[model samples]
Target chain A: MEKENIRYSELERLCKEFRKTILKIITEAGSGHPGGSLSVVEILTTLYYLHLNHNPKNPFDDKRDRVVLSKGHSCPALYVILAELGYFDKQELHNLRKVNSILQGHPARVYNGGDEVKFVPGIEVSTGSLGYGLSVAVGMALGFKMDNKQNLVFAICSDGEHQEGSIWEAIMFAGFKQLDNLIEIVDYNKLQQESRIDDSVSLEPLKEKYISFNWQVYEVDGHKISELDTALADAKKYKGKPKVIIAHTVKGKGVSFMENNVDWHGKAPSKELLEQALKELEGK
Target chain B: MVTVLEYKPSREGLGEALLEIADQYPQLVAIGADTANSTSLGKFAKKYPERFVNVGIAEQNAVGIAVGLSLVGKLPVVSTYAMFLAGRCWEEIRQSVCYNYSNVKLVGTHAGLTVGPDGASHQILEDIALMRVLPNMSVIVPSDANEAKVAVKKSLEKVGAVYIRLSREKLPVFTSPEEDFVIGKAKLLREGSDCGIISCGVMVYESLVAAEILEKQGINCRVINMHTVKPIDTEAIINTAKKCKCIVTCEEHQVYGGLGSAVAEVVIKNYPVPQRFVGIKDKFGESGPAEGLMLKYGLKAQHIVETVKEVIKYK
Candidate 1:
C-alpha cells in the first residue's frame, strides 16, 4: 500500500519549524547544546516525517521501527519532533530540564520516582553518555534480524562522539555481524563541545573507517532533504552490511551567527538572540 | 558430614542453565565478549546459534548491545571476564542498562582472585561495589555450581538488570540441586551461637569449612550463604548478628565493597555488633595458583576461622 510520497518542499518546511521549536525549548530551558541540535534538525525531520515506520499513538508498538538518539545532547530536536507528532502534549516541551520534569537534561527512561518515563513515545533507549546509543541500536538490529522481523533500527550520532572508543567497538560489532537492518546517521557538523572536532580529535578518513569495517558508507548534504531521503532508501535496500550516512553539515545550520561557531555548541540563546533567530527563521 | 559433589566452574553452570531454559524461554539470548569458551557459553552458542551473539572482545559494546536486545523484548545474557565487563563497561551498564531498567543479565565470570595466575589485571574485586551502587541493579554471587545455575535461571525469569558473578576455577559443589534458590533470601547453612560467619560466592563453602573447624575449638559458628549481594538478606544478617553477638563476613572479593560491606551495612544500621571481615584487605592479587592465591589473599577457610575468633573476642 503505497502512501502519498512526502514532497521535498514539505520536508524543508518541517525542518524550518523543527529548528524554530528546538531553539524555543533550548532557549526556554536557559541551557542546551544548540549547535548540534540545530545541525540535526533536517535529518530528524526527514526520519520522523518520512522514513521512520512509527505511530505516535502506539509508540511502544512491537512492530514499530526504533530510533536511538545517541547524541542525546541534541535531544531538543527529538523532543520537538515527538511533540509535533502527538507522542505527547506540546505543552510538556516547556518543562524541559526542569526539576521533576520527564524531559530530563539527558535522555532517560525513568524519572526520580522509578516510574517508566515516557516523556515522548518515540524516544527509544535512554542515551546521553557518548558511544552508547549505536551499540544499543546494533543490539536491536540483531534482535530484529534474529526474530526475522522486517522492522529497522536507526541511530543518530554526533561526529564528536566518534572519539569514544565504545562507538568504534559498536561499529566493529555491527560490521562483523552484518546487521543490514541497522542505519547510523552521523551529524558531521565538524564541531564538538568547546571546540571543533578536528581540534579536539580528528575523524578524518571517517568514511574510509566505516568502509574498512565492512559498512556501506554514504555521504550526503545533510541539509538537503532529497539527499537524506535517497541515502536512507539506499541504506534500507542494501543487504549483507550495516549502513552509515556521513551527512556533511554546518554546526548550527540555518542560524547565521551560530553556524560553524563552537561557542554555540552548548550555550542557549538569550531572549534578544532568540527573537533574532525566530525572525531569521520566519524570514520577517 | 556434608557430602560434596564433583567440582565444576560456576561459569559452566551458567552455560548449562541457559541451554536448559532455551525451550522454556524462547526469548533468552546469550552474548559473549570473545570469552564464550572461557565463560562456558560455547555450548549455548552451538545449541542456539541464532540466539547466541559473540560481540568479540568489546565489553562495552556487549553490555550496550544487551540493553538494545532487552529493549526489543529479548532477554539478553551478556558475559565476559569480570574485570572487563564490570570495570571497562561500568558506564555502559549504568547509563544503558540500569538507567533504562533494561532486562539484561550480566554474568561476570572469573571474578575475584580465583582468576589466579592471570594476576590482578584479570581479577575484579570491586564489581559488587560497582554494580550495587546503581539503581535497579540486582547483584548475585552464587555459592557454587548448583547455585550459579539456579541464579542464571532466576535472573532470566526476573525482569530488569542483574549482575551474576561467577568464578573460573572448579569449586566444590556445596549446594544441592533441590535447594530453594530465592533472589534476596540468604540460606543459613549452619546454626550456632558463638559467632556468625556470613559469606557468598566460593567463600560460602569456605565459611562452612570454617564452621566445622571452629566447632572443635569450642567456638560454635553459624554459617549463612548470602548469595544475593544487593537487596541483601538484611533479616538474616541482623538476626545472625543479634544471636551470635558477633559477626564475621567472608568473601572472595575485597573487604571494601563486597559481601563484607553489604553485611556490615545491614548490621550496623539494624543491630550494631562487633564484626571482622575476611577478604582482600586493599591488596591486589598476584600471579599464582588459585589455591595459593586464595591463601595469600586471605580468602581461605582459615582466614574465616581467624576472623571468627577475633570478632568473638569483641563480643
Candidate 2:
C-alpha cells in the first residue's frame, strides 16, 4: 500500500528517521558503515516494503524474487531493512555483531522464524567480498528464467565496487542473455572507504560502459523515492535488455557532518555525532 | 532410478540425462563454455534450451554462474573439461563455489591421460588432487560408464559442493546399473586375501585386471573402487589393510593428495601398512596415445600386478 508517489513527502521523512535508526544502532554497537547505510535508506525502504513479492511469514517460498547486496559493508542499512520487514525482532537489531548474534560485521546466512528455521532468506547470498553479488544475481535470474518463473532479481551495487572484475563479467553475461528480469541499482555514493571513488579510480563514462554492455541504463536520485520508484517500474516495463539504474546518492545523505565526507564511509557516528544526526533527521 | 542401457562418455550420459533432469527437477540447470558437445551436455541443451547457459569459452564465467545458480536454489551442473574447470578456474572454484559451500555439481570431463591425441594440455591428471583438497567438496571419480551413471545419480543427493571428474574415453562396463554406488563408500570389486589394490576412475579396471593376473600367479589380491576420494572410506581401506597387511593404490591422477594419497592419509592415520601408489609421479605426462601413456607411466594392469607383488614381498 506504500506506493512510491503516495509517500513522496513522507519518503523524505521516512528516510530521515531511517538514517536516525542506522546511526543509533551503529553508535550503540560501536561499529558500522554509517555513510553508505544512511545514503541507501530510501532505496532499501522502497524495495523491501513497497515492492518485492516476498513473504515475511514464509521467507523461503521458492517463487520469491531475490536481492543481492553487492556492497555488503553497508550492512547497517541491509540489517535495518531486514528488521523493518520483521525478519527478526526490532529489539534484536541492537545485538548486531555481538557474540552468537545472527547479524555479524557482515551479513551472513541466518534462519528466520520457526519451522522454516533454514537458509539466509532476505539475503540471497552472503557476499561480503564486494563485486561477486552481481554475477550471483545474474545466475539467479537465469535459473528463474529457466524454470519459467516470473520473478524479478534486484542486485544493489555501489559505484565504488565498479572497479571489480566480477561485476563486469556479470554485466557482459546479462547483456548476452538479454535478461530483462534482472535489475541493477547503483548506489552512486561518490565516497569509497579510502577516498572519493572518482579520485581513486574514475568510473567515468559509466553509463556508456553499461550501454556498451547492452544494458538499458537509467539515472536517478537514489533518495528521491518518486524517481527511484519510476526508474525501477520503467525498468520492468522495458523488454529484451537487463536494466541498470545509476542512482546518484550523496554519501551519508541525511546527516549533516557525515554527508560527502570520505572519513564517514565505514566509521560509525560517535555519541555526540549520533545525537546531532538524530536531531537533524528527526526534528520535531 | 533411470536405467541407462548403453555405455557412453559420462559427459555423453549427462548430455542425455540433463534435459531429463531439467524437465523432472525444475531446480536442475547447467552452465557451459562451448564445450557442451565435448562434455556431452548438448542433449541437455537441446531439450531445455532456456535452462542451459553457454558462456562461450569462458570457464571462469561458467563457474561463477554455477555459484550464482546455487545461491538462487537451482542445482547447476557446470560442464567443462577437467583441465579448465579445476585447473584454469581454480580461483573461481575456491572463491565462489567452494568458499560459499553451494549445492553445485562441476561436471569435469576429459580427466586423466586417457584423453589422448589432444595432448597434455587437454589431459587433466591433477584435477582429482586439486578438487580433493577443498573442504565441503565431494569428489566423485566414477570408474566406468556404469559407475559414472551411478555417480551422476548419486551426486544429486550428495550435499554441498560436488566435483564429478569424468573420463573422456569411452570405458568398458563392469558394474550393474542396479548396484548401490554411495558417494563416500568404496565398492569392493574382488575379494582376495594376499594383497589389496584400491583404485578409482579408469584405473579400477586396471586394478581388477591386475587382480586377475595376481590370481594366475597365486597372489589372491583384492580390488576396491575408491570413487569418492575426499571423504575417503577409511573403514574400507583399514579393513583392506587388516585383511592383507599391505595396500596398492591406483589412479590416473598424481600419487600426491589424490585417490592414493587420500587413502594413504586415512590408512596412515589409523595403521601404517606397506603401500604402493600406481599413479603419475611429479613429472608431467608426454603427448601419446591412450594405451601408450598408460603403459609408459606405469598405469597399466601389469604395473599394478608388479606393484602388488612388490608390496606383498614388503608385507
Highest TM-score scorer: 1
Clash pairs of candidate 2?
A: none
Tens-digit lDDT string for candidate 1 (B159-263): 888999999998899789889999999999999999998888999888888888889888898889999988898999989988999999888878898888888
TM-score per candidate, chains pooled? 0.97, 0.87
Q: Over the stretch A94-184, how does candidate 2's per-residue lDDT look in tens digits? A: 9876765667677666433224444554666666777777887888888777767798999899998899876787899899889899999
Q: List the candidate 1 regions with Cα displacement exceeding 4 Å.
A: A1-6, A112-120
lDDT of 2: 0.82
Residue-level lDDT of model 2, residues B33-87, one tens digit each, is 9888888877778777777789887777778788878876788889789999999
Per-chain TM-score of chain A in candidate 2 equals 0.93
lDDT of 1 at A163: 95
